[model samples]
Target: MSNPTLDLIRAHGSCRRYRPDDVSNEMIESIVEAGQRASTSSNMQAYSVVAVTDAAKRAELARLCGQQKHIAQAPVFLAWCADLARLDRACQLRELEQSSEHVENFLVAAVDAAIVAQNAALAAQSLGLGICYIGSIRNNPREVIQLLELPRLVFPVTGMTIGWPEKPPRTRPRLGLEAVLHRERYNPNQDEALLAYDREMAATGIYEGRQVEIPGRPGEMEAYGWLEHSARRVAQPMRTFLREVLEEQGFLLK
Candidate 1:
């Protein structure tokens, strides 16, 4: 019942509610250390983290993230930044030419930032903390950048709201193993597998009951099924707020 590994991976789930308890400063540092331990490309290790505890800042961040109230509710909001600025500035301080101005270096930093952030999330979950990634952070990157005082060569890849859970959440069912794993190849049988998985999801009644504010009919990521909710997501072209924000932040993905 106390497998540390399962505590890290298997039991990990996104939790939005909080009990008003604060995450201790030491725990926050440990969680950050876990993030720093994540593998990086070429050991480049290019990333920075901005921990936002200010209520006003979190409220604005919540607004930027599709107005998700949890962003504001959580006692801590960590913004994982893909930062080449620090490296560049260090280079400049030594009167050396900057090498990370290229697209490859930029992408490398961004990808590494995401990897590390997930590492932190899992670490928090293992330490009895709840976390929910706010991908909508990209919707208004300029504002976030300004609020965080990020430099030009740095970008906020994503934000996560973390806190103690108010109540435990049930485990959600996953698709059969065959649906995802491959045998030394990339072959996929999409139609049959998806159909079967959809039915299984429906039978669980995960999406049957929910209150959705979107223009379309009712949908639920919390309930009737994961498949139908995913269907609704792809049914209409979702906003590319991330793309817009990246461009605004000078992420010329050439």
Candidate 2:
């Protein structure tokens, strides 16, 4: 029931601090090969990865991603892209009209990018490399597009920093299986599991001093947990310009 792969998967944790070391090109290619083995929608393979090691570019990327220092510290920064530009070329080769503007098409490409990136992540972990996924790559989408020289119909879905961990990474707790998994139909009544998880997470002190204060609320909270933190995140408007950016990238999202 237990194996190295499963152990690696369970041991997975995001590494923000990295030691100063270079990732070999051969190892990078091997990781990419693992990513390429991920399943794709209709074999369209609508994704691409840009591996950046240039010091200046990595600094700029770190700036674009809300100044995450790990990006600049890591030996390699990978920009995983949802790429339909190649699909457009394929249609041109066949002299056929391509339908890449639909929302469904965009979803397929985004999902493809995510799956491949996770495969690459696991591969890197297997090789004793640490990685941290940077969703803030979209903080300055247009600048990122320009910086990475991404063509139309190609969007950077996410980024990842890769290097040797400065120390052993800490594994964070996740919601209980009862909260996420249902037997058959979706179960809306999970308050019991939710409160239990809140207690479990509160004991870790991960959100200490980071509790969000909602406007119009009078008093400070006595207990802060995952639900409150997640609520604070969900309550805020994030990436509101993404629709416009997608349109500019040739994904009409119709």
Question: Whose lDDT is greatest here?
Answer: 2
- lDDT by residue (1-254, candidate 1, tens digit) is 66878656766667878888888889889999999999998787889999998888889889888899889999999999898777777788999966654578778988999999999998888788999888787777788898899887789888998899998745567777787888899766777777677667766666666434433545423333556579778988655566556655555665
List the candidates' TM-scores in order: 0.85, 0.95
Which model scores highest in TM-score? 2
- Residue-level lDDT of model 2, residues 1-254, one tens digit each, is 78998999999999999999999999999998999999999998999999999999999999999999999999999999999999899899999978988999999999999999999999999999999999999999999999999999999999999999999788888888998999999999999898888767877888774554444686654467877877779999999999999999999999
Prediction 1 global C-alpha lDDT: 0.80
- Candidate 2 displacement at residue 18 in angstroms: 0.2
Stretches > 4 Å off in candidate 2: 209-221
> Which regions of candidate 1 deviate over 4 angstroms?
1-3, 94-96, 99-103, 209-224, 241-244
